[model samples]
Target: MHAIEKQKSPMQSLAESVLDAHTANFWLQKINPLWSVSQPLGKIIEIQSAATDTVSLKIKVNRHFLMGKAGQHHPVIVEIAGRRYERTYSLTQLDQYHVLLTVKRIAQGVVSQWLCNTAKVGDVLHFGQPYGDMTVTPEQQPALILLAAGSGITPMYSLLKALDYSNKISTQTITLMYWVKQHADAAFANYFESLAQQHANFKVHIFHTQEAPCDARLNKNHIDFIKDLSNSTVYACGPSGFVNTAEQLFTSAKNFKSEAFSLTPIISDEGGFINVTLTKSNKTIAIPKGQSILVGLEQQNIQPQHGCRMGICNKCSCNKVQGATKNLVNGVENTEPRNSLRICVNSAQTDLIIDI
Candidate 1:
């Protein structure tokens, strides 16, 4: 009869645990085995005008920086007015050591303003590894469907350009549906038109919500398009509520997928912090309201496996054995025993028991 003893990790200790600063550093160095792989740190090399307010930046990354997938996003860390800020932008085109990122100048966007107003051609920008799983695949099923809104077309542009560049245009049929408030608001509409001129497998459908004589109206025709897509493989990206109606439109459709790295929402959880126990690590900790549990844990020097900070990536998915959460946008509260929550977007409102 051998006796088994349980050892607690530093994050597991309720009270302050003894840890040497150097040991923590050493442990962090070995934490994610593949974290050492070189990632991009872009430097603005050139900027090209695409539209009135839209600018396409040609950034030069070192060769060691990993090139992103056709539809992946990379976090851009910038400093403005002595304050640090971060934003994610999808690559418009992937080139060797120079990926093109196009951004529309928002009226009051902090980082976008800085990049548009202050950052010079030679300014260095810290970039994270390419993240996001919403990518187009050549081997993917036929009749690919892409839906986007405003700047959401960033990822779609990458995928379309990649396919055309690789001469894989004949592999799959694609129907790209884009919507904008006005005709002037459309980005890369001319570009899509130019590509459609030569490519036979791609088609573009633009819906100008405010203008007359547009090809498609907003009401129910979009739903009809969703139904017509055969062997459907959906890839959508955009504002929070832009496409919420699709869940019902494609309830019966298969291979439905969406990607949104829109922004870090500031919705208040209102409720106070609650305690949570990470079962795998045997850790107990208090989680604050109005803040993502995953982020709060990271602030306390606790790192749960995370990829994209957005819930769409599912890298931060954790099993919820107890407690409740209100879906910020959908209002569909999630409270199932074996169900998983994307901790990146979910906040703790009550004491939770998690099987992390």
Candidate 2:
């Protein structure tokens, strides 16, 4: 006897007849908001204030959503006023079917403002697959140091929760040094303090940089308390300047990993202007050689697709038809044609043509 095959329903059969997934999804979504052939979707289940300008959103993910490792980031897409906008944010997994997304509202930031003020429970959100190499593992070093400044604390918090969930927090000596402008700006302060109270090997320190007697910014003095530099693994996340300082101070440690959420464009001394031609737009613009191509294009009112804006996510990457560009992050110069170019971190070093 032949094995029996399950029969498809009329809706399912009709959906399969659609020419494209998008067309099928357009109808499928009308039946069920989370129903989709490929796109991952989440429903906001809860919202709470994380800090003065920050909010923590608990999202219940659908079956298509792929869970990410601790310390990874997800590109969150939201639709506002008939326009779609995307931004990346660090996520903390709450359970098998849910995740926590904490967002700090940025001044003049469209998505941030909408998420912070307008979004409510039961609102649906779109998510890109999680990406980022920095992740927490079980076989980490005995001593761990976490350095975070401002919104960078999100990833560090996720890593810590992972360690705690895996029962590794009790065995390893972990120290978190977090910097914020004021006490009200610190997110998850009470949670960290409670966790430290329960674990003998864990310590949490919050530094208020703008208080009356301001705590000094990340410096060599901050690591003076750690006795085992050679056996310690250090992780730092923040603005470029803060991460750079952490790298300078902790390079001697056993392992040092850092990620900068924001980068200040590395202005080159080789001053001049270069012409960049947009192949698809049929427009030519003069851009400064020292500044990033993304910044230059934005100055000329050419808004390109971008996420993170720190060169980590490749959302801003485009095809360089022909150009001599220098990477601001690593200072590497590429003169090749028909190559992938990340405009957020690369500056035009000569007259160029790009597919934008």
lDDT top scorer? 2
**For residues 1-356, could you state the per-residue lDDT of candidate 1 as single tens digits?**
01223353454242224445445434433652212123335678897776657788888765345667888887777878788676778875555657887888889687777776667787767676677778765568777788887788888889888877787766677788998877887888998988777767778888887677655533455766553554678787776455454444554555777665443344664656778888998999887765677877987788787665666556678889888765533446776677888887777667888877
Cα error, residue 122 of model 1, in Å, equals 0.7
Itemize residue pairs with steric clashes in candidate 2.
none
RMSD in order of candidates: 11.0, 4.6
**Tens-digit lDDT string for candidate 2 (1-356):** 01223355578577968647888878888887877766889999999999999999999887778788898888999999999888888999888888899999989889999999999998999998888877766577899999999999999999988888888889899999999999999999998999899998898989999997899998999888677888999998888778878888888899887778766566667777899999989999999877889989999999998986777788899999997998765567999999999898788889999998
Candidate 1 structure lDDT: 0.69
Clashing pairs in 1: none
> What's model 2's lDDT at 44?
94
Off by over 4 Å in 1: 1-39, 212-219, 226-228, 263-309, 313-322, 329-331, 336-344, 347-356
Report the error of model 2 at residue 69, Å: 0.3
Q: Give the TM-scores of the predictions, in the order they appear.
A: 0.70, 0.87
Give all candidates' CA lDDT scores: 0.69, 0.87
